[model samples]
Target: MASFFAALMNSLDIALLLFIIAIGLNIVFGVLHVINFAHGAIYMLGAYAGYSCMAMLGLPFWLALIVAPVPVVLLAIVIERLVLSRIYDRDVADSLLLTFALMLILNESIRMVWGTGIYVIDPPAMLQGTVTLFGNVTYPKYSMFVIVMGMLVLAGLWWMFNRTRVGHIIRAAAIDREMSQLVCINTRFVITAVFAFGAWLAAVGGVVAAPMRAIDPGMGDKIIIESFIIVVIGGLGNFTGTLLGAIILGLIHGFGSRYFPEVNLLLPFIGMALVLLFKPYGLMGSGGR
Candidate 1:
């Protein structure tokens, strides 16, 4: 029973982090029809930025978390204006190719900037150790924070899309770019804003996960595939679907690592394949816009 509780707690953080990382990808896809292959690289950069702020500049962990994502958000805006903007009207394949190229460029650049060694990020002093729970089970406070942060983001997104006027415009533009523009919506602005916002979410995930995971140059490469699988299984543009898919993947990881360690790495892929086979549009996808 203790083991079961431990696994469940473990999956919560995994599910939350995956949701944050992949939700941005889904948003970008939903708004721009652009598959951002470089998103994981952006995530890696965000983590690196947080590490540098804390380790090199002597910033507080809390401050670093707040500041780490700004540069990446700026970078995303520039990428949209300079590279991604060009492919918006072309074949979707163009966006894919451009993003893939950007990913390679970012991977090499990150190595150049941070070298190849694995870096460590210590959790805040207050969260440095485990906290005791019922039945004397101990859980990491940082993981709990991650889960709370994810919940906050989920609520924020819900409010943004369902209650805000800007969200209405975003949704309208996403549904029909031409029609939205006819109604005087600034789709260009919305597209750029949404892309930048998506980048911010990815950066938040990276910054949050840095203290929990070993930071390495190959981290982005490792996560990119998982992000793609999450996006696919969740549906191309469905936020709620992303949540469900993230939870499912987290459970797969938790259980597979515990009982089927031999096939641990393959479980997520298997689940993704199964989802694709039975529900090609995903749990809540509406096909294409």
Candidate 2:
């Protein structure tokens, strides 16, 4: 029973980490209608940046976590203004191609800078210990920290989307860009802001994940596939759906690996296929723009 509880805690950790990455993908798709193929690269950049700050500069983990994502967020703003802005209304294929190209460029650039080696960041000293749960079972404090951070992020996102004026404006733009423009909403600015915000979120996820996962050039590629799956399964353009999808996928990854190892790798895709077959628009997706 204790072992089962430990597994459940681990599953929650995975789900929360996924939510951090997948929510950003959902928001970008929800508002900008672009697939953001470079998102995973941005995530990788965040991880590397955090790694450098902590390992080389001798900064504390907390400081690295706070400072590492800023540059990536700025890069996103620049990319939005310079590249993505040009493809806003073009065919989806065009945006996909452009972002795919951007992804390749970013991936190569990361290799150039980071030397294509696998790196690992140690969890903060405060999070290094294990907590005794029931009798003999133990759980890492770092996992608990991750779960807490994920919940905080979830709440923060909820407040940003539902309570703030900017959130309302963003939702309006997502719902009807033309109508928003007619009402004097500068949707161009909103789109750029949304893109940057999404990128920032992805970067934060990367930083959070770095201590837990091996960092390498290939990390971005792996995450992009899973991130894309999460966004699609949750319903494109649906933030709430992204959360649900991330949790479900996280659980599948965690429990499936333990209980159904033979087919674990294929389970998420199977679930995606099933969801698409029945809902077509995704669990929370709406028809049309």
Candidate 3:
């Protein structure tokens, strides 16, 4: 019983992390209609940047968490303006190819800068210990911090999408790009900003994940596959769907690995296949506009 509760808590943490990454993907797709292959690289950069700030510059973990993702966000903006903008009206296949090339370039660049090695960050002293739950199960305090941060991000994103003027602009663009432009919304600017925001979210996920997992050049590869699965299952370009998808995948991974170890690796893809078959647009996805 205790073990089950511990696993459940851990699963929730993993799910939250997935949510962070997948939500960004959903937003970019939702607004710009571009599937950013470089998102995973942005995530990797976030982890390395946080690692450098903490290890090389001697910054506090909390401070690194705050500052590490800024440069990536800036880079994302630059890329959107200089490169992604050119492909906006191109075929989806063209955008995918271009972005995949960018992904390779970014991954190689990270290897050159950070070296091809695995790195890990230690949790801050305050979050270093564990708390006992349900009599005997112990859970990491850092995991709890991650879960809290994830919830805060979800709340913040929801407010941004539903309450703010910028949110309204983004929503407008997502609903109908040409219509938004006709109404005098600078959709070009909105697209760039939305892509940058997505990169920012991915970077934050990387920073948060750095302490929880091994960080290497290839770490992004693993998460990107999972992230794609989340977005696809949740519904492309649907924020609420991304959240639901992430939680479902998280729970699947959590219990599947524990209870059905032999087939754990195949379960997510199987579930995705099923979702695609039954509800081609995704469980929560409305028909594409």
* Stretches of model 2 off by over 4 angstroms after superposition: 134-136
Ranking by lDDT: 3, 1, 2
Total clashes for model 2? 1
Off-target runs (Cα >4 Å) in candidate 1 are none
Residue 227, model 1: Cα distance from true site in angstroms: 1.1
lDDT of 1 by residue, 56-170 (tens): 9999989998999999999999999998988888988898899999999998998999899999999999887888766867999999899899999999999999999988999
Q: Give the least accurate 10-residue stretch of model 3, judged by summed lDDT.
A: 2-11
Q: What is the lDDT of residue 190 in candidate 2?
A: 95
* Residue pairs clashing, model 3: none
Candidate with the larger TM-score of 1 and 2: 1
TM-score order of candidates, top first: 1, 3, 2
- The better candidate by TM-score, 2 or 3, is 3
Displacement of the residue 162 alpha carbon in candidate 3, Å: 1.3
Evaluate model 3: give its TM-score: 0.97
Please provide, for model 3 over 43-67, each residue's C-alpha lDDT reduced to its tens digit, 9 standing for 90 to 100: 9999999999999999999999889
